[model samples]
Target: MSKSATIYRMVMDGHICPWGLKSLHVLRSNGFAVDDRWLATRSETDAFKEQHGVTTTPQVFIDGQRIGGHDDLLRYLGKPVRDPEALTYAPVVAIFAMAAFMALAAHWVVAGTLFSVLAAEWFIAFSMCLLALQKLRDVESFATQFLGYDLLAQRWVPYARLYPWLEGLAGVLMIAGALHWLSVPVALFIGSIGAVSVFYAVYIQKRELKCACVGGNSNVPLGFVSLTENLMMIAMALWMVAKPQLL
Candidate 1:
């Protein structure tokens, strides 16, 4: 004889009937067809209670297997019951550091102190820019290693090292003020570049790509954290450009 298809059984008092109804809705939503006949108390099967040792209403059985009660069902749905508030200390630190540096730059400019504080700001900004570009280099290096491709061996690609070189050069120009009018544009350009890099990192994570950012310390999903950091950096760069008197 062919074995009968196992029917799901649920029992609930009127007070807890809504939970069963909601579970039925979810079952239907997930494309599982359920017979409500098993829900009727008058004709319900005692076979389930005898086999599974269930002594409670709101008990559930699927395919002859006990699935537990209402609370257990909700827990099985994988919905987040609680989430911790996110922290943002890194971005906060970057903002305060930039603000302090700018204040010192402003003081030096006002006092007509030639080439001390201004040079310091230039060097600091340059260091930050280089660090950001280094992140890009690390990404490229990782891709090559993972893909096992000799990118430099192919002349058509030629390793694409020019972009980082240009970034470093831009840092130099920001320091030298090659064209006094170009300082703002350079700062804006550098800021724009960093913003794009950070955003691209976020985009990759959203697409479920493994992040090569910060050498594997950035395994966390991209969200408000990356966005805030990028925005802060862009703001700092713009502030430096618009008010050159504050470096």
Candidate 2:
């Protein structure tokens, strides 16, 4: 015999509960024949909640065993739940992935090619802008975190605050293929300082720290990832100077 479950969920004209849909989908995906009970109005939902002695809807029952809401349902199935407070590299990874996609898409549209010297440049520039935006979202927070390990930022408070703006401006100028004289110098100066700072803090000092590369609220561990960001900037700066000569 097949497993069976019943779910009481909110389904109204103006609003639909996403948790309810998730619950239904989970049950069906797990090979359960679900008896979906839709609470169509405010009164109906309230009445159901009162009858069941529960505060929330999207309640699931399997063989008279109550499986609470979406989170509870996942627990019942022995699934790993996401912890929002946990430290993760997800933000940085997502930004890089998005930058790569955007670079490829822009190159395809303009150059009728998937790969080129210009596309590679676009990828790095786009990543720099996106990463800078994350830090700029809350400059004070970013600066505080940055000062913890960044050598230059610790000595010069204003540099900590202005770093994101400088990074973003250089990226924009590079992308526009304008003001190479300004962009190249900015990228090189900051990138060299950042690389030296990160290398000393993480490798030489062997001190563990959080990366300010993503933002102030970032949970990404400082080390390889932070070093990579600076190195890429340095490479891009040098490339900007040499590319014209080669092409």
Q: Which structure among the candidates has the greatest TM-score?
A: 2
The per-candidate count of clashes, in order, stands at 1, 0
- Candidate 2 C-alpha lDDT tens digits along 1-247: 9999999999999999999999999999999999999999999999988998999988999998998999999999999777766778888899999999999999999999989988999999999999999999999999999999889988989999999999999999999999999999999999999999999999999998899999896889898888999999999999999988998
Off by over 4 Å in 1: 1-139, 142-160, 175-183, 193-205, 208-233, 244-247
Stretches of candidate 2 off by over 4 Å are: 9-16, 37-58
Q: What is the lDDT of residue 108 in candidate 2?
A: 99
Worst 10 residues of 2 by lDDT: 80-89
Candidate 1 lDDT, 14-41, residue by residue in tens = 4335656665665566455555535455
Per-model TM-score, in order, reads: 0.33, 0.82
Clashes of 1: 1
Best by lDDT: 2
